[model samples]
Target: MKIEVNMTETKSNDSETITTTQQTSGAKNDSSKGPESIYTVPLLKLIKEAQQQHGLRHGDYQRYRTYCSSRLHRLRKVLHFPQGDRKGFKKREVTLDNLKDEKFVYLPLIQAERAWAYAMQLKQESNTEPRKKFHLVARLRKAVSHTIHLEYICQSPLCDARTKLEAQAYSAWMQGTLFFELQEWKQASEKLVLSQTIYEKLASALNEDEQILYKQRVEELNPNLRYCAYNIGDSSAQQDLLNMRSKGGKSELDALIAQTREKQAASLLEVTWRGRTVPVRLEKIRVFLLAYQGLDASLGKANDCDAKLSAYETILLDCKEAIQSLKEDLAAVAKTKVDLQSSQLGSQQYLLSYLTFLRATLTIDRNLVMVDVFQKNFAAYQSGESKKVAKPQEGVKLYEAMVQLSGELQQLQGMENDKKFQNDLELLTKVFKAFRCYYMALTCQGNRQWAEALALYQRAETYINQSEGKKLGDSEFTKYSRVGQDLAHLRSLVNSGKCAAHAQNILGVEDINAAMSGLSVRSKKVYAAPDLQIWRLAVYKLILYM
Candidate 1:
């Protein structure tokens, strides 16, 4: 077998170029050259030629690196050379005699190949043992150094360009990869941009076959660049990268960006109160406002409200800590005898009270919704339908919570000066009172206590009527008035003895003559036309006896 190798080098002030030509002649059964022939053929050339012919599969970079490293190690062993440790051969041990030999020129390339493989392996394992990350970084640096040295030795114009670009691009890519793993997003983004630029330029100047090779390389770099862009909040760049084509249509980067935006929107709040923006530095107030908004948003979704309620409860805990700190600051201000009327402490107190009111309102609203859900479920279950029903006691607990929160809102200090706050508080108080009465009536009705149910219904009606006269707007007044009328009718039904009469099935008995025999003609007419409570009660007595 005979092999011929040619090297050409060109140098200009603007650019350094290299070119190489090689020919190989050997039979498939030619084994006389032995393992030493592996070094004579450049590992990169073998990989690139295989890839161009579609002999190498996609994503086989690590596999090829490993194979080449093993072949080079076997070759060194065949030649009675020392098998280096995992970190590569010691620099001092490589003699001048070795450097003078042609085969030794490939040693650095082989070392670089093994180093990159080791770095990638360490990277995968570093998540569990974070200390390994530093070692991985060191290995990548070593790989870069070996590749740079190989570039110096293989100075053919084409070979130089290829090796130089490969070394630089791989170094930038690996550095970016390391920074990304470490969560240094800004640095990762910068390095990845550099790698992408170099690959693009190199691809543009190459033949179609070479361009396809670099195109795949550039494609692999896109996702990491997009990921770094997203983490560093570069929305424009992230979008541009996501819009680029990969194996198919839009990239998963778009989905990732959408998900991140959704989470931010859910947890974020921008509050402007009394013509002033709330600064985000107040962590507790910010969190409280976020939860407040979250609760409002959750109200439209039936099944999701419970999770939002839990989040609001957690925010309240943060509020407690903030409130205590403010109280301490207020006490210090008080000892100094500062003007209490226009002081920052006064403002803090007012803000705290407002937050407390907001928290209370959200709690009341959540409990009301819970009570309604429970009622609907219970009704469904009672109609002999298969439905998931919450325990009736859960509704009772929610009702009690609503009442407690309403009371707390009413007692909050500094609300008197805020007309809008005062009006809302008064209206909510009336509404909660009505709710309490209505639930109590239901409890009494369930226990068959007609008298107690009637009394509670009347109280509820009274509360609704009172709310209408409390300067409530026309819309609120109209709504409350209608509710009051409904309650009034219900109370009358319980008070007229119709409930007892209906329970015994006496209202519409078929034997009307017998049913009304004990009643006067006038009472029979009252039974026929019972418009008022007195008439209904007279008819009920007559029917009960018959």
Candidate 2:
């Protein structure tokens, strides 16, 4: 048998200085050509070395030395394995005979006239295979190491190929939107255009829900294209007001205002998707656009426009407040748990298990990534930007929520009346393996990460549609809306734009979401209709963040 001496095994503390190197095959280098690796020592050298190391004719000392050397060689070969041997290479096993076959075994060599082999041979029942005799403990340890590595590789393959791509796309989209808001027309236009392109690429790489998110985000941006037209109107309105033209006007400006209103009304805000139109409010800029054209030129007309703008602003503010309040109402519902009986638990457990296994196999952290991604794609949501603005802390980063089901499953596993629960658990394990990829897409869209977010969301939403469908009733819808609205508001306010000083208890919402997410079908249906406004107000009431 041949032995391969990998000299790269550096002693633990001396990991830097020492490294193993295998002697080249069939080569005879100079003995001192930098530390030669000796393996299967030549007969002459082996004798000479043994003689030098020990008085072969003497006591137990020689036997001890031989055993120690042999054992050390074996241990080193076993534990300090080289990397990436998916099919591992084997080492030459030492062949020696006993000098005394009674309490001990010994080498046939005179050096160890009284060596023990029993102690060296691994212990096992006589029926155990020789390989099996080699401790399962060792195999288990190796398996654990391999499992951990596999887990890590399986967990985030998307992040490897595409984290930066999606993040950049989303960041670009967000920048476009921010510029649009700040009225940086040229830059905003360029950014939105870029965002659209990136989103297209992302969409192709994404799943169904992700595709939906891309559509939504694109829709959100579409309406904003008219932002430039609105800004132009704003400039005119401000100019007119600053000039106090109304005090003297009613004459020339009146005609201009009428023309402007006609054009502005004629060119209303509309977004087209799949050849279908979705209406959006351009009210924010409509009045300005109309006023700029001088349709309402008199002081009375200016006053009317002013009154309308003020009223609209108040309405928008009220909506914001209502949305905020809705968020709180949903959060409270999430915090309240509604348990399922054994029968109900079985189905949900099955769903959760299936989703979990699907997630694991797909290699996503959680299914929420799909939702996040889809929202971003649709421009219904954006990803997180900074520390001040919190993002969705669901499935992608981890499947903490899904993983919790394990505890419930374990409890079921021990119960006599949990046959259905047990079955569901098994099903869960199978499907959950395929869900991670979906989760990744969802996360990519959340917290301002649109590209990946959109993709992830698509996959996850598709999963749910396939799995749960319209059964996701008011409770489910409410739960999702609450979290999304809260997140959107929080993010908007982070840079002190809109929705400033949003909810402070991020985890509180998360806890509620998780709890509500777990409620049984009947229990969920049984629960009171959730109120998001009340929830947001509750969060506001308790929150201390300025």
Candidate 3:
């Protein structure tokens, strides 16, 4: 038995009235009866039929979609009022003009429901077809527009206080949800906030059951709102959302809040660049966050050095893209504004360079780790003793790349003028050069080039000494003092290499002893076997010379 129920609501200044008219296939219902008495049983029966026809399995999106479409059709048939001759009217020919002329009171509400159903279906399809999802979002927006028009133009106080506001809030919330699915975070946050406000105001007018539903809706909106706020870097809004207590204790929410707080604190540390407050760049912040997260993930894959390298490379690429984006944004602003403050621009450029520096530093660290691994493996391959084996070429390439980046950073305007930046540049310069020389010395020593190895070690020692002079504090002074001791030990190695070479040649005892005396007096600490070998060779050479 099919029944059509039509409801029209009218509002006066003081009161609201709803009039229902019903048409049934079997019999005409009483005209004065409310919709609950006449339509509830039929609607429930239709829903039950739909559930039976399409199994109620959890992931059956198609079944759910069919149910929604069937329900929408039944709802349209009930609320639809005939305005013109049905003989010429086609269902597919319905337009906004036709809807207006027919004065279909529930048109917007039905359209919103239909669009919402399609949106849900699209969402369940996964992220493969973004264009289709975006099209659905546009349809949802149109539904929102219709709901807004109904709120203003519909004269029914029954519609105004309850139906109209509910439609508006739901439409806004759906729009926000669609925007979030599209990854339009800023718009999503704004729309969600609007929806939340409307729901809060509408809560007061609802009955106890409806009010409970409204509260649930508001609570459901909070996580999405917080997600959008976080992506858009609206820390205050995020914090507010985090402070909201959930009815059920959510461990995930607590963990997410704690993680966000950590990121916020870390981002805050980089907020000030070169003693000047720079405007927060969400893109840059995102890059930093991704880099840190990628590094953490890569750490877990310790057995896969190539994977770690790829991860670091990806981060470097992202950082470079972010730097380019910043430059373009700055250029666009410069073209329109005449009194452009250069300090802010300089600070932004410095920040970009600093990020690049960090990536390069990471690259250097990876290279050093590889070098250590190679050295260990090489030493293990050759019994337990170190050998003059070929060094990894990647170490040299990475060091050269780092030097190039540091040079570019130093060449930036005002880099030399900023004392802190200058110090940092100089320190990096010394460190890279020292490492390069040390590696070259090892390579030359492996190749049995005593003279070349001695020269490279001397150059490395000179860089270390220069680095020591740039120490800023007592701790740094002590740190460099240890570096100086390491340099002295490297000098002993150089002496030993020279002694080994001299032993093969005809050298006087006086010259051999003089070198040994110089090495012994430089450090009282015992040298490694290589150094001892050189000393013994020197003594042998001295005996031969004698």
Greater-TM-score candidate between 2 and 3: 3
Which stretches in model 1 have alpha-carbon errors above 4 Å?
A: 1-177, 180-281, 287-345, 387-392, 468-546
**Model 2: per-residue lDDT, tens digit, 1-546?**
222334456667443222221122223343222232222212223333454455433433435456545744454445442233569765422121210111111111211211212212222232355664345334333323332332232223212334334434444554554455345877877867776776667667778855766665554554344444344555544444323333333333443433445455557554332233444233423334234234224323534434434433433343344334434543565589655455433332332333232223222222343434433543433433322432344333344444444335445322335455444444343233224444454344335444444444444444333333122132212323333223333322222321121222343455467678778966654334357546865776566355
Indicate the residue-level lDDT of 72 in model 1: 75
Q: What TM-score against the true fold does each predicted structure earn? A: 0.45, 0.18, 0.42
Q: What lDDT does candidate 1 reach at residue 358?
A: 56
lDDT of 1 by residue, 391-485 (tens): 44565567567667756766677545656655655675666676567667666666766666667767766776766545444331232343333
The candidate, 1 or 2, that scores higher on lDDT is: 1
For 1-546, candidate 3 gives per-residue lDDT tens digits of 222333443445212122222222121455454332211111112333454566433445456556656665665666464333556864442343333222244455445555655665665563687667666777567656655654443433222244455555665776786787678989988889998988787677667865765676677778777878888887677645544422232544554555555565455544544456555464555545444554664556445666566656655666666667777876886799766455544655666655655555566656655655665665565575655553535445656676776677667654557666656666766766776776676677667666676677678767767765454342312323333344455556545655554454333344456557668655765433467556866678778558
| Model 3 backbone overlap count | 0
Clashing residue pairs in candidate 1, if any? 17-157, 18-156, 18-157, 18-158, 19-156, 19-157, 19-158
- Root-mean-square deviation per candidate: 14.1, 36.1, 16.3
Alpha-carbon lDDT of model 1: 0.57
What TM-score would you give candidate 2 relative to the actual structure?
0.18
| Positional deviation of residue 215's Cα in model 3 after best superposition, in angstroms | 37
Off by over 4 Å in 3: 1-270, 282-311, 334-347, 381-394, 445-450, 465-492, 501-546
